[model samples]
Target: MYSSLTEIFKILGIVSIGSFSIVGLCAFLFKKLFDYYLKEELARTQSNLQLKNEKLKIEIESTKQNKILAFKTLHEERALLIKDLYSKLYLLKVEYEKIKLQETSLSFEQLNSIEKECIEIQKVVGLNRLYLTKSISENLNELIKKFERTNEILKDLFSIGENTFSSMSEVSNYKPDQEEIEILHEKLISLISDIIELLDKLEESFKLLLNIE
Candidate 1:
């Protein structure tokens, strides 16, 4: 009976150890599976975040490009209008000089008609006044007033002086406020330069801004 009891205890000890080993193996496998699942979840989350970040970057870049393109388009259109208007002023300057000098082949009647009906430049200003910068628009209006005033002064000189345009150009006494006329010419030249410079700067800035195209 003593030996049998000892043998029974030994068998029970072996059975207990076998059960513990099985439990430990199961626990180890479960732990490994859990760890693998955790790592996969973390990787997936990181990939999702990376995708979102890339998409957001693309969206921001697209928005910036759209704004830049819009600005370029608007300025390009405005520049064309400004260029045409500037050219009109140049033509007006030529016609004005003609009238001021009373050049041959053009009757005073024709020049007087041109002076009175110098509405083309005014019309261009009125139509696109909103497009022009405030300084440029105001300066152009002031120049127009000066042009008319200068024409009136030249007309007065022609009436007082008794000679043709060729001889009249040499008469220093007939010139009323010649220095003032010179100043007006300078201002007009400056304005033309300003318009040209502004347009050129806009174009150059657009080119420099976009390296992609």
Candidate 2:
């Protein structure tokens, strides 16, 4: 009986040691697998992040290119608009010089048309303001203000001259008060010069904004 019990205890001890070994080995393998999977997932996430960053950079560059293209398109249209404005100013200046230098006059209809054109110009200038640089915008606005002032002066001058002429009983004759005419001529000339200066500054600002001449 004693020998039999010793044999039984030895068998149980071997079985217990074998089971512990198996459990330990399984736990070690599981740990290795979990570590490998964790590393793989981290690497994949990093790669995806890098790809997204590159895509964002490309999109930003594309947007900047689009803005430059839009600016170029608007620049061409603005150039033509400025030219038209200058022509109108020149016409007004020439007519005023005629009246100032000699006893000459533009018909009421012609003067009225010019006044209407000035109003139209005031409306159009606001549209161009979006495309202009800060310096150009300010300078252009200055010129526009001067133009409006000149238009106001022209209206007053014509009203006075026309009323004076009508009172003289001569519809075809043109005459102006010598002192008032001299003062107006000097003011008009100065205003014209100021407008021209502002125009030049605006052109310079445009070229600088465009990186041109």
Candidate 3:
């Protein structure tokens, strides 16, 4: 009996050690699998984040480029409008000088032509006033009014009908009555001075808008 009990105890001890070894092996394997899966998931998350950052950068750059292009287009258009308006103003000035210096009696055709040109100038200003500063717009209107006044003065001088010359060369050779020619000539000179001043102001305003030194 004593020998048999000792044998039974040794068997139980062997069995317990084998069961513990199996449990320990299973726990170690589980830890290794968990670590590997955790590393893979973290790497995936980091790659997704990097892709998102790259996409965001591209969108922002595209927006910036579009704004720059829009600004460039606006500047070019504004410059063209200003240049065109100035050229028209110069033509109007030439017309006024012609009426002021013409030696012959002004024809109805000449009067109508000046009026038509003035209307066209006004139309341009009214349509493209957005491109001009408020002060410039107002001054342009004033300049057109002066053109009208000059045309009216020319009509009055033509109505006097006392003197007629074939050529502008004869204007300096003939002296006119003080009451009529002197007054009209003085008015014309004053209007010309005003027109010049307004032109200078318009030029300064354009320089400011274009950021010119």
Tens-place lDDT per residue, model 1, 66-124, is: 99999887777676766676566556655655543543223455546556545666677
Ranked by TM-score, the better of candidates 1 and 2 is 2
lDDT of 2 by residue, 26-91 (tens): 999999999999999999999999999999999999999999899877777766666665666566
How much does candidate 3 score in TM-score? 0.67
Which residue pairs in model 2 clash with each other?
none
Candidate 3 lDDT, tens digit per residue, 1-213?
999999999998888998898899889899899999999999999999999999999999999999988987877777777777766666666766775686444565666777887788789888988877887788888877877777777766665233655654554355445576667667767776766776777666667657897
Off by over 4 Å in 1: 103-135, 144-213
Instruction: Give the Cα lDDT of each candidate.
Output: 0.63, 0.68, 0.74
Better of 1 and 3 by lDDT: 3
For model 3, the run of ten residues with the poorest summed lDDT: 167-176
Scored by lDDT, model 2 comes in at 0.68
Sort by TM-score, best first: 3, 2, 1
Provide TM-scores for the models.
0.58, 0.65, 0.67
* The best candidate in terms of lDDT: 3
Name the candidate, 1 or 3, with the larger TM-score value: 3
